[model samples]
Target: MSSLRSSELDGDSDDSQLAAKFWEVKLPDVVPLDDLKAIEKTQAAEVIQRAWFSHMDKIIFQLLKHTICAAENCVTHEILKKVCPSEAALVKDPSVQCKVRFRFGGKNFPPFIVFKIFLHTGGHGNKYFSGKNTLRPSSEAVVDACKLMGNRKYYDQIIQDQLQFQKYKVADEVDVVTMKDYMHFTSFLDETPAYLGGKSNCWRRLSLENFPKTMIMYDIMDYATSGTLSDRLQKELKYLLQKPKSKEMHHDQLRIVSQVRHWG
Candidate 1:
């Protein structure tokens, strides 16, 4: 009788946990700035600034969340059954490149696969803005955890029991493969806000203030309204894509590739 009672209690406990998990992963209401304030006094421009920052907070969170998950192991296989599942979604990294060259053996060996490797660092989630009421610097813990991960060894034993690699035997005359790694450094200062970290609507306080945010967004579109940089990009693309023997516009195609602006 005791064993049967324990089994019944376990089933009820599991159901309660499942219900809690479902509610945890459910979506929070999206904020619409215009709806929050009447457009009578506030211009659409400032309204949009708030909206953009709010939505950006969501995007930045996803980009960094997985990195935190891997770095801190904050979410365990067990918590996965209880915590917010949006936090547990699988992330795919396209770091290793594989090229296979087949070898013949009437019945035997596997083909040689050449691998080109790259390393990736990921960003944490919107939890950075979590505990808004507690005055905690948002997602700061996760961000610190992610940055620390970069300083650590990202890979485990090269030939551990679960994973291994064999050398790709290049053809007799081919050059040997070389491995290289590259890293870039960036410096960011000060605490960040939950939304629009440094962006401001200070102009909203002035009389007769007006903002044309839509026109501004439209004007920022590449090439068409993007102004001076557009001219340079056209020249660079023309130069790089030029036909080998075509001789016209030699001046246009001769400009330095580095001089072109990379951003769209």
Candidate 2:
């Protein structure tokens, strides 16, 4: 009876070990391949999102510091270098001049910030300085500005005021008889231009309304030069302008005119 009991106990032990080995082999097979892939993709996306947020946070911090310096009227070369080291380095050349403009609110307007960089050759009415300048507080900057202001309503009011101001300024500069005529001349056609499609028009109109006219013009010119614009559009504009060099000039002129249009 004792021998029989020992043999039975050994048999039970062997069964338990086999069961453990079977489960170990089947565990991986039980998890779906799709689930494993999904887990990997999620992990990758999380890593990318974390990197993007970290980058944006640094930009916001720098913008906030620059704003504070501007508000205090203590923005200097040293401060600018600290705030934007890369831009400062670019402007270190003697030919480049940097100007910082700030607008604080009164009863009519809210605060705004602008940075302009242009070529300075110590001459009057030079072609280089005409429209060859960098203007900042871009659309991205505007979003950052809204964040800094802590009030979207005020920022919206500020944008409206800026739109009005730009219109009046253009009219006064060009001696336009009325804003109505200006808008009529720049009006969107009933059909999209052959060079641009419906999708391009949609985005262009949205950009025109939301961003500064000069910046939009610069971007458009860049697109045209970089071949980002449609081949047909480039060919047509080049033919009409008669000179490839004049494309930028024409765009700049249009920019001034379009600034007055009430798209938004």
Candidate 3:
């Protein structure tokens, strides 16, 4: 019995349970709203635009596709490094910009994470370059990339226009927006009636005299980004755990299965 117990612990330690709990506590670290405007201010427009260009599609696809690939590069890479270091290392290289290849509909999407044209070589001949994760491009690089990419570019135009009306939107849409309503609209992926005009108590006008629009979007994006990742990882890990562990149902299997059959 002692030898058997030891063998069981060695075979299936169930590391994922700890991982799931770890995820709950780990998500909020990256959602610093106060820092977003600072990020925008410090980052160049071009680099931001390029980061969006390279990684936005992947982000959207992952969200809409699996709905759980929510971890931003910084978080995802760290977690992945713990779970699968070899895979994480591929994209962590400063020189190697990473793009998530989506294999769906019998098609393939290649890696696209690149923001600048230049590359850096580390001391040990490792190629170190910035913009490996374009979505989170360094602020200065964003500005530089945007200038190089051009002013009338679609992304720049859209962001510029959006920032102009941010003050109005915050006053009319965000600041007064209640927590419940915000959760409903965002968590449900509400898009039909439109959040601002939607017919729900969750949508109400609150005084934004003290609210800053820049601060609001910054906070909103951080939540959206990190929450998405936490939700995704949990869902996938749960699905994996519930899968049957064996093909046969022997007498011993039945006894083992019945002993602690709470999981799946």
Best by lDDT: 2
- The full ranking of all candidates by TM-score, starting with the best, is 2, 3, 1
For all predicted structures, in order, the TM-scores are 0.14, 0.22, 0.16
On TM-score, the leading prediction is 2
Write model 2 residue lDDT over 167-264, tens digit each, in one string: 54431223345777555322321122322211111111111122233322323333422425434334333333332267575444343323333333
Quantify how close model 1 is to the true structure by its C-alpha RMSD in Å: 29.1
| Off by more than 4 A, model 2 | 1-29, 74-264
lDDT of 3 by residue, 71-172 (tens): 231133533454446756876776675543322231334221211112234444432122322323458766886788687773654464365346434322
The global C-alpha lDDT for each of the candidates, from Candidate 1 onward, is: 0.31, 0.42, 0.38
Against the true structure, candidate 1 has what lDDT? 0.31
Over 156-227, each residue of candidate 1 has an lDDT whose tens digit, in order, gives 221221231122132111223433111100001011222322112111110101111121111112222223
Question: What TM-score would candidate 1 get against the native?
Answer: 0.14
Candidate 1 wrong stretches, greater than 4 Å = 1-42, 73-264
Off by over 4 Å in 3: 1-138, 154-177, 184-264
Distance (Å) between predicted and true CA of 7, model 3? 99
Return the TM-score for candidate 2, rounded to 2 decimals: 0.22
